[model samples]
Target: MTSRPGGRSARVREAVLDAVYAELIHRGYLGMTVENVADRAGVHKTTVYRRWGTVDVLIADALDHTRETDWPVPDTGTIEGDLTAIATEIADTFTDPERRQVPAAIVAAALQSTRALQAKQAFYTARHTEAAKVVTRAVERGELPPQTDPLELVRLTCAPLYYRIFVSGEPVDRTTAERAVQSALAAARTGLL
Candidate 1:
């Protein structure tokens, strides 16, 4: 039989994952150590090693946990409002110095580790799938055409903000979020998506 959700095994996993996130934010990927994470989690180093085996796996497991957590999908009664809310949230996350380190570290780790790379891809896929609900809702409400691809529209809505944060080194604000939403809406209306 499977273990209960709140059993000792689950608690250990939760503590270790939380420690991994804290360690990653504090020391980044290169400086993060399994011993340090185990210490922070109040577990022995060998326990961490026996389970995760490496720093990359710890980070991957943390990401997997995050992906499984429920994200609040926006429902503002309009496609524009929902899309804007989604884009704004992305801007808010990357704009925060402490929160920004997690994704930055993930990208850095994915470059060197295949496990991290797959985890990163799966994380984004889950997020995009969840956010695509807004587009799907818009179609049901007759705001967007039936042919519009919900996932593609969701990706278009997020792409520009990510481009600014990860590519162009540009400042992202409420106005940037609005622009991204409008651009994606325009694309959807024109059947480009």
Candidate 2:
């Protein structure tokens, strides 16, 4: 669906996605409903159903919409600074009670629906692509080897954070973010990533 910026359709989409986000955080994928989103968005239920067709599809679209506001590559002068910034950005999300639920729900939804899976993949792909630019800059600065894999470094940096929250059920804190930065930096320096 095409929504011109600042148009009524854009406003409606924004409202629906806002409601979807809140529902994902509070109700999760299985519990989130189009009716609930419509109610929260103050729109007719048929509007959401007609546009997205299913809860999973609506959730996917909502998640996809988040990319515009999500992860940004830091332009700090050093690779260490950039990695730390990136890790901190991720850590902050996991540490925030409200923000954390979104990722958790997305992961859970991906396991159950193809649309959610695609959304999850697209979300990370965009994030990784943006974050990889930091490493690409570092390579140009001679901080990393010319052959360094930017996305590999990006993935390594994020892997532990994801594992900590999703698998180990551990708290994601500033220290956790720092450790990931250290590990990924070491790996990048050693050409291990």
lDDT of each: 0.91, 0.86
In order of listing, the candidates' clash counts read 0, 0
Cα lDDT tens digits for candidate 2, 1-193: 4457788888889999999898877877668889999999999999988998787787788888987686556998999999888888889988887777787778877887899999999988988898899999999999998899999999888889989888888888889999998988888888766
Q: Across residues 1-193, which tens digit of lDDT does each residue of candidate 1 receive?
A: 4576878889899999999989877887778999999999999899999999988888888999999999999999999999999999988878887777788788877887899999999999999999999889999999998999999999998999989988899989889999999998999999777
- For model 1 the local lDDT of residue 45 reads 93
| Top lDDT hit | 1
TM-score of 1: 0.91
Q: Which ten residues in a row have the lowest lDDT in candidate 2?
A: 1-10
Judged by whole-model lDDT over C-alpha atoms, candidate 2 comes out at 0.86
In candidate 1, which residue pairs get closer than 3 Å at backbone N, Cα or C atoms, i.e. clash?
none
* Candidate 2 residue 51 C-alpha distance from true site, Å: 2.2
Question: Each model's TM-score?
Answer: 0.91, 0.89
Clashing pairs in 2: none
Q: Where is model 2 more than 4 Å wrong at Cα?
A: 1-8, 26-31, 68-71
